[model samples]
Target: MTQPILVIKDMSIVFSSPDEADIEAVRQVDLTLTPGKTLALVGESGCGKSVTARAVLRLLDRNANIPRGSILFQPEGEAATDIARLKQDSLPLRAIRGNQISMIFQEPMSSLSPVHTIGDQIDEMMILHEGLRPKQARERTVALLDQVGIPGARQRADAYPFELSGGLRQRAMIAMALACTPQLLIADEPTTALDVTTQAQILDLLRQLQSDFGMAMLFITHDLGVVAEIADEVAVMYLGDVVEQGSVYDVFARPSHPYTQALMSSIPKMARKAERVRLSPIKGTVPAPKDRPVGCAFTSRCPYAFEPCATIRPERTEVGGGHHARCHLLTRQPVEAVA
Candidate 1:
């Protein structure tokens, strides 16, 4: 098997309050992304999906602390580098951020500067990351816009972000992300604010770009439908921990974690018939980071939870090749019990 391009081992993030209380936003999360594959992080709000994504790029806020773990990036044909230990002033990451690992945010309107022309914005990245001359960068920027399926690339490149439609803005964002031929792309809810048609278009575009560049992708999303469309592997998170992870087909077909089952069942299906296919909403909201439960965070919502689940946290154990889940039920009882 090919070696992974990015490897995150036992990564954790904490936020220190003014009162000196620590809020753990992420706990012992491990993930790997190989070239030409995509891993989707799926969960509800406050499940630490976004925090995990931010940690990969070292984009966390001021109060956030990475107390332990390593984010190792092995650039193509290069030695492994620890991104977590790199200093802020160091130019080592400059080659990685836009040039090797690009990111597309949820809100393009907020991510893109309204004052700058689309072409100029993309050219800025090319200049900084690739050191292309101004004229050369502008030429490549227009081609990138066209490559992303933007209509009237020459004219549209001159328009400010505010002057473009939502779909166009998203395409522009994709153009910027692909400007430097990155080896990995982190997409944080890239289709959140768009309509259904536009969302489909953007996803299709991403898949095509992934194939064209053969770059690894870390796609963060809450929607299972979106996951079905893009992910090769799926990691289900709950309140800062990965509850279940496996190939997309196995996780969706036979979810071992109770939380994963609940999420899958909630998706509306047209073929299924019932008085009403009841959507199983997880009982309570995710616990606040400051007040995270000691044991399994999903114990309160898990139907199969027993005494052990409430006190002793479960270790991630392999149920099948590359399929793992964290739950006491997996340890104590037969896998049949949870299934």
Candidate 2:
């Protein structure tokens, strides 16, 4: 759509260890993000959400591997570049890492330096990318702190990660990520481990700031409720593959995949005294990435599965209006839909 700001084409990622067979962390996944829009990648742990996000930034650990993929980044004024092809720690990639693209990791407490003050931490990125002197960086850091709703910006900037509450630390992380005004932000569950109220506040802050900065976001989260609250588009992953992708409204209101239907039914909803709604949990666990089925990886857990589901991987088929699902059931139209 509109020559997406970021387009991932047939991307795959793997993790290899000397003693073990290669584990496919990500399959032939494809995703796109237009400018100023948010795409939520939601799935259970090991569904390759984080790995895919990390691949965009070239931030995976040493053991991780990518046999093939192309992450085409089309920053406004520049020619499109394949971030997946660029060397991870090279100069060009480095410039894009925190300059054009920044990330707010899941655990600021662990990701943030234990040795530095919050102000210094935020200042580092600006200094590195914007070439700001200490004084200017500090001044802007204070401003960003205030903008992100961290009270007493001046004094709190001097505090350490341990000194601030979980929420405040997350705010500081956001401030730091915004220091360079990146074109895209990959937020790896930034609200994880926070209270519900705090999560809502952080989500609100993220939406406000993303709008203000006009940056695309790849929001990796497992909470469908949160997806409804913030996402414009959503990609549902299972066992290293994206089984469904579409507008949040379309996907949530009319889920096509059996996996997606099961996921939707599991969302806890509010009900009155006479309207008790029991959650329909999916039947089985996700298969191990290293030894998943050659066919639809979801067949082991899918309820409407048929013979082909166990032998051939279903290609993505359109349900309606840009909504697609990779389930064989999509072929048997009037047969049976998940209850």
Candidate 3:
């Protein structure tokens, strides 16, 4: 069996507050990513998907702390390093980030510098990580821009981020993320801001790049359509917990958790007029971290929630080949009996 490149076990993220109680944004979440495979982390907004991804890079805010968990990353022919324990500005971490692992932010405009040319920005990464001279780095930057389908890459590289359109800006961000040819890439809603055509193109570009580089990916998004297209494995999160997880084919084929089922039902299905049905919008909003339920975080919103769901926490139950769900309904007595 192939070994996993990254493993996150029982990770919980908490944010400190002065007057109020500390907020636990993520709770005991586990994820595994293998080399050259894509694992999609799907959930609604404020569901801790982004926070969990950021933890792998040790990029959380100062107020945020990992009270528990281990983020173990194994580089090729190297010993496993626990990223969770590394200091934010440690030399070892600085060497690993942007070299072995890179991240693409949700917004290109905000992530890219307005003062620097796109070429300079991308070149800096190569200079820092690969120790390449300015002249050589510029050559590689232009090639990277072109590789990401940017038109007039040589000239465009000299232009500031504001000079490019949304699609071009996003492409530049991708180029920068790929400059060092990282072993793993964390993409946090990389295509969320683009138009439909641009979104598809970006997705295709990411897939092509992943194939070319043979790198693992942690794809974070709320869109099921995008997940279906780019993901090999899928983990469905709700509130601060991973409710269901399995292969893309398995989870999409047979979603075991109620939250997962609700999310699937909310998708816009393309079918004949006779077969069409109204979209089922999931009721209730996600509770704040401080307001998280004692048992299942999604108990307030879960339609199939039972008596045990409100007070007694449920453990993960196997749902066949490598598939699992954290739900009381999976292991408890019949739903009708509980109801």
Candidate 4:
């Protein structure tokens, strides 16, 4: 197997202060991202999709508790380091954060500083990491803006986040993410709020940038359409657990888990101008973190669930080459493959 840029093994996360009960948000998620490839982490809201990405950057709230697991990250030319064990905001982790692995947040307007020019923000990373002088950093910043498809890069660098259009602000965000040419990029729903046309443009730009930089990307989103467009591998999450994972072609063409099947079916397919289209919504709501089912977290919502599915926790088992799913239904005959 090729060495993965990141290896998240049996990772679990909880949120709890001294007085409150623990809210388990992520449960033993294991994911891998090979160099220069895009791994899509797909799931609906509250499925720990965003939380998993935040955990990698150690950007969780103060109450976050990671009791088990290791986020082993192998920088392009360095030995692997376990990020889970690193102290938050420590010098080493700080250097790794934007220098070795950077992230593009979901909301560019919120992530970018309203008080500073976009150039100032993007320049800060290179200045801090590479010790480039102010003039040199500014030049690099303008070049980055141009690289991410921002028009009038030099002038745009002086603009504030609120001053730019949504797509432009997102382009600025991508520019910041690629400023250091990090080994891994974690993009958390970076195109959620944009129009379809703008979203397509941003996706295309990201694909081009990722290829040019040769950086591994952990793409987090609930949109299967986006997954189909950009992902090399797909991990389907349900109620804080990754229930199914495989190559994008395999997972979309042959979803092996009940939850994955339902999600794939939920994707909206275009119809002829005259034909009416409908999405097959998933049957039940996601269980609350505090009230998750004891056996399989998705058992309550799984249609093909059996007595064992409701009584015993299903373990992840390999269904095919590099494909695995957590479901008791797989223990018997194979689940029906969806198109």
Candidate 5:
């Protein structure tokens, strides 16, 4: 079996409040991303998808803390570094963050610097990480922009973030992310803001780049359609905990968790006129972190939730062929049987 490029084990994130008790945003969660594969973290807003991705690079805010778990990143031919344990500003982390790992944030308009030209921003990464001279870095930056399908790459390199269209700005961000040929790329809803056409182009660009570079990717999105289009593996998150995970095919074919089922049902599907039905939106919204339930985080919204689901947390139960879901339904033994 191929070794995973990144492994997250029992990871949890918390935030300290001055007057209130600490808010635990993420619970014990486990995930693995093999080299050259994409793992999509799917959930609604505030489900901790972005927080988990940010944790990989130690990019959380000052008040955020990792109370438990380890984020192990092992680039080929290098020793594994525990990102959770590394000091935020340590030299080792600084060297690895942009060199071996890179991220494409959701909003490029705000993420990219307005003062600096796109060329300068990308060139700086090479100059800092690859130790390339200014001329060499600039040449490489132009090549990267061209490689990502940017027209008039050399001229666009001098353009400010505000000067380009949303699609072009996103392309520039992708160019910057690929400047160093990072081993791992974390894309947090990179296509959410773009129109359908531009979104498809970005997705294709990412696929081509991943094929060329053989980079592992952690893709964060709430779109199941995108997951079907891009991801090899899928992990369904509710509140903070992962409720179901497996190869995209397996999970989509047989979603065991009620929450996962609800999400799958919510997708707009085509049907004959006579067979068409209304979309089934899940009942209720995701509770705030402090209001999360004691047992299953999804119990409140799950239509199939029963007595034990409200009091006894279910462990991850194997479905088949490496598929697993955290729900009492999969356990086979009913509440009456246990009682």
Candidate 6:
């Protein structure tokens, strides 16, 4: 098999409060993104999906620190380099951020500068990462907007982000992320706030762009429907850890972890004609970072929890080829009820 474009081995991120207590926001998570594939990090809000993505780009604030593990990146034909250990000032990872790896955030209004015109915003990265001259960068920027399906690209380039509609702003953000033609794109719920039709367009645009670029994608979303549309693989997260991970087909069809099953069951389905569809919500709220559970962070809400599950954390065990789940029930029964 070809080497992966990015490899995250046992990556952990912790936040230290003024009282000196450490809160693990991400715990020993491992993931890989190969060329021409998409990995969806799915979970409820505050489950550390976004934290994990930000850690890969070293975009975490000073309050957060990487406690363990490494994030390795291998450019198409280059030697593997450890991005986690690189100095902030001398980060060679910059070469990957916009040139080889890029990110499209949830809110375009907040992510794109209000002061900068759409064209200037996209051109800035090209200038910095690709070293393109001003005029050349502008030309590419216009093409990028058009490529993302934004009509009247040349005229819109001169407009400010606030002046554009939600969908247009998002398309502009996608254009900016693709300006450097990155090999890996991290999208953090890029369609969270858009209308349904706009969301569909954005997702289709992303899919089309992924095919055209053949870039690996780490797409973070809470919507299972969106995952079904674009993900080749799925990693279900809870609290600070991945509870289940496998091919999109297997994980969605036969979810092993209680959390994974609950999340899938919660999605509103269309085929069923029952008076009311059953919604299995994982009980209880996500525990505060400062007060995480001792064993499985999801133990409080898991229906299959036993004494061992509450006291001893389960390591990720292979359930099948490329399918793994962190749960004690897998040890007891081949299949068990999640709710």
In Å, residue 308's CA in model 6 sits off its true spot by 0.9
* Clash count, predicted structure 3: 0
Q: Which stretches of candidate 3 lie over 4 Å from their true place?
A: 75-77, 273-276, 334-339
2 against 3, candidate with superior lDDT: 3
What TM-score against the true fold does each predicted structure earn?
0.95, 0.95, 0.96, 0.94, 0.96, 0.94
- For 2-28, candidate 5 gives per-residue lDDT tens digits of 888888999999999899988999999
**Model 3 per-residue lDDT tens digits across residues 129-185:** 899999999999999999999999999999999999999999999999999999899
lDDT of 1: 0.89
- Taken over the whole model, the C-alpha lDDT of each candidate is 0.89, 0.89, 0.92, 0.89, 0.92, 0.88
Candidate 1 off by > 4 Å: 75-78, 273-275, 333-339
Of the candidates numbered 2 and 6, which has the greater lDDT value? 2
Evaluate residue 115 in candidate 5 and report its C-alpha lDDT on the 0 to 100 scale.
94
User: Candidate 5 clashing pairs?
Assistant: none
Model 6 residue 264 CA deviation in Å: 1.4
Candidate 4 lDDT tens digits, 1-339: 567888999999999968768988999999998877999999989989988998998989999978999999883447668899999988879988878888887799766889999999999978888999999999999988998889999998999999999999999988887888898999999999899999999999999988899889999998999999999999999888999999999998889998989987787666633667677899979989888877899888878778887678798999999999998877877668998
- Judging by TM-score, tell me the better candidate of 2 and 3: 3
Report RMSD (Å) for each prediction in the order shown: 2.8, 3.0, 2.2, 3.6, 2.0, 3.3
When 5 and 6 are scored with lDDT, the better candidate is 5
Winner on TM-score (2 vs 5): 5
Which 10-residue window of candidate 3 scores lowest in summed lDDT?
330-339
- Specify the poorest-scoring 10-residue window by lDDT in model 1: 330-339
